[model samples]
Target: MGTKWITFDLDETIMQNPFGKWVFPEIVNMLKKEADTEEDILDLIVSEHLQRMSEERFLEAYDWDDIITDVAEKLGAVSAIDIERMVIKHSEPPKIYLLEDNMLDYLEQIKEKGFHLAAATNGYSKYQLPVLQKLGLDKVFDEVITSDSAGFAKPNPAVLKKLSDEGEIAAHVGDRIDHDVLLANRLGILSVFVHRSLPAEVLSLPVDKRAEQPSCIRLCEEKWHKENRLREVPFMENECIPKVVVQSIGELAESIDFIIK
Candidate 1:
């Protein structure tokens, strides 16, 4: 039988959220609007804004409206609806790092080879799903698992367990060695490490496989650079690692074929 399942990691694997940039300001604005003083506003953002998305018990009761009301009410606000309106207005056309053109083609090729795919990444679905839709490859994957959805983020065995349960993932491809590769290995699932250059933190992990040519990643970096938009695209300068690193997603098919055989 074919391997059938391939789980992937988002953010630096499929997309990248530039540091110090996001929709935080809008949330902050809402806090400021409701609060009587700056101290009160900061307190609300600190108290309510910084919670783990996977806290299901908290999130189950805390929908978007609840989140707005909770934050606003913490600062002594009157209307949750107004805060939600501002939040949604600020959240309109959710910001996303777009995927490379080759991504769609590569995913199609992988599916043609009979592989089922899923995404296992950190962050809530609100932030993550938009990027998938922007990539236009949302329909390609059989499932998209998120840390928020799973109630745990990467490097956590629980996330991998949820990924495996989705179908039958034979392999997981990602950029972080500790969070992605090592986690996969812990569960006895094959791991493929992407990016030719890795951070010292990631390089410290024992990686099973590596790849450098991440087209989707490259495109996102290029767009950010071209747009002069927000944060700088982090690029690795060294090429000294001693592992086989391919330049494109299509190359993964060949590498996996050899490994599976």
Candidate 2:
């Protein structure tokens, strides 16, 4: 495949965050130590922080460390040390479900074929980077782009603009239609959506191509003698809808190989 570049998503695409179970519990425990009323603390501090972010709001808000401090102060008795410890504990990662069957092997295959690769996610860069390293896949990416750094999240054309600015990217693969497929489609990059969590019937709407998983995409090469039904699905949305849907990153490679050829 003569494809120049490929981009990917992080959470649910590469890994899973057990934060709902582990991280939340840790936060609750720390809150217990504070001398303030839990009611007021949860409402004022936590709620305000969770509100939607605008450029102005983001600039006005506390940085990551300061956010921790605000939460601790709300408890009236929590310590910075405790907050730090909790963060460190929860940070133990890869947080991804590294499915056993030679996952990295497929990525290496694409790399060997000379395609540039990147990751564009809505997550924060500071936290997302550590998870990639834990999976030992950090070195695979030529670039790691995140919403925090990009100043805009997915479905935003500006983020796609960043991808184009870096180089000529051929495809963008991700799990969500709204953020990944739609946005990629709008940006003129071939969009490939992996239906790992969603069923095929549910996505029966027109897509350039479809597959069960990343590995299965190899069928494009495996059955070279057979006519490949590959589709050059373009981005789509207000003109941004993704044209292709696959099951895994491996399949994304296969589709790309077929498209580029």
Candidate 3:
């Protein structure tokens, strides 16, 4: 067989953008005047997005413009110009941080072992590309495939099929059990789950402070459940179960070797 490929999920797997997922909340705050309450607007935005995802299996089915425009029309409050401006302002490149120390070094070491590496993520190139550049990982991957580029998302075997076309995929690493593990299991590839536990400082932050920085609340909540050994989703089926699990990316190389044996 040709050189095997090792794929990774970008967002919570390789890096953490503390504020990336909180963009919608920030938008609700900006348009507070247009809606009756911030909570109402936020609920509408999230519900509408979820509805779209349900109908269109692709994660990138509807862009922000479509969702925001629909929300505005329902409320009949915000203007087109204001919505456009808010989207632009909040869409700036987010400050990204590596989830683990020596992330780049670890990836390079894996590459040197003769395996081709690829980043198979469920995101648009416009956002994911800048993240790789910021983390100095732009040169590490032989291929960087996003949902927008692949025209498909995780848990769908088609995304991995594209990567497999270049070379056989030996394994896939990601933080999500549902999306990442499920996708790998379906394709008969080794699935590695990297558990991202937040630092004590982040977990102990005041509730008010967490609210000030939107993603903190989510980070803290997830960490709490993990620390307590609780599962957010009650049951895990065979497809969703990862073949191997590690605490951090620093241990990823060893896990990959374990799978190879």
Candidate 4:
């Protein structure tokens, strides 16, 4: 496959969470004073997040403000929203933009080789586009396809195919094996898996043990679509053992070269 275009996953593939650096640390520190321990607060938060991830209702859109405030109120801790507002008001604080390590140079390197770059991700366009702007990577990708535009998320062929032109050879690079690799395998396109966040811990467990409740997700989505439904969408049923896995974005570039040849 002589790949003409390479599409990438946004979060943790080449983009990270912007607020985690300052916002979360402050919340944690605040919680630590009131909670039994830092670890306990952390565990609470993680548990809530995992619960949300497993719940089909809250799976798609993450409400961080709600999560922080609710967690704060529950734990009898200082309001994270208040602390965040104060932090923003008081001083000219440091701003940390989200981008994966070595992502820029690698993208540039590929572009120099005349490869068309794009992004196909499972997110709302409103939120995801701003993230790309903040990272100054808005222009890096030739095109960006989101769930909003695609009418569905990855593992559904439509999202990736949104970045394609007729007869164009393409490869998708992402961290999630099920979302990215399995989707590519199904479409018979080149798949490159980047090991970033979300360790494949979900994979080691049996289907019943996994966190993703796809049936619930589909039901919720179906309801959502029915009220605002356009057409039918697919669901995540099974996982295929991924064939192309890499440790970093830099490695992805190498893999792209190897696969294309």
Candidate No. with top TM-score: 3
lDDT of each: 0.55, 0.59, 0.66, 0.59
Q: Judged by lDDT against the true structure, how good is candidate 4?
A: 0.59
- Tens digit of lDDT per residue, candidate 2, span 45-105? 4444444232224322323445556666756754554433443456564434454356577
> Which of 2 and 3 is ahead in TM-score?
3
lDDT of 1 by residue, 35-114 (tens): 78657444454444334222323333224445556667766877445433343334323344533446667777777777
> Distance (Å) between predicted and true CA of 62, model 2?
12
Q: How far out, in Å, is residue 170 in model 1?
A: 1.7
Where model 4 places Cα greater than 4 Å from the true spot, the runs are 1-3, 23-52, 55-101, 165-169, 196-239
Please provide, for model 4 over 28-141, each residue's C-alpha lDDT reduced to its tens digit, 9 standing for 90 to 100. Answer: 877777766445665666566545544432324344555667777887766435543533432222343445556788888777777888888776565566567656677788
lDDT pick, better of 1 and 2: 2
Query: How many clashes show up in model 3?
Result: 0
The residue-level lDDT of candidate 1 at 67 comes to: 59
lDDT of 1: 0.55
Best by lDDT: 3
* lDDT score of residue 27 within candidate 1: 58
How much does candidate 4 score in TM-score?
0.58
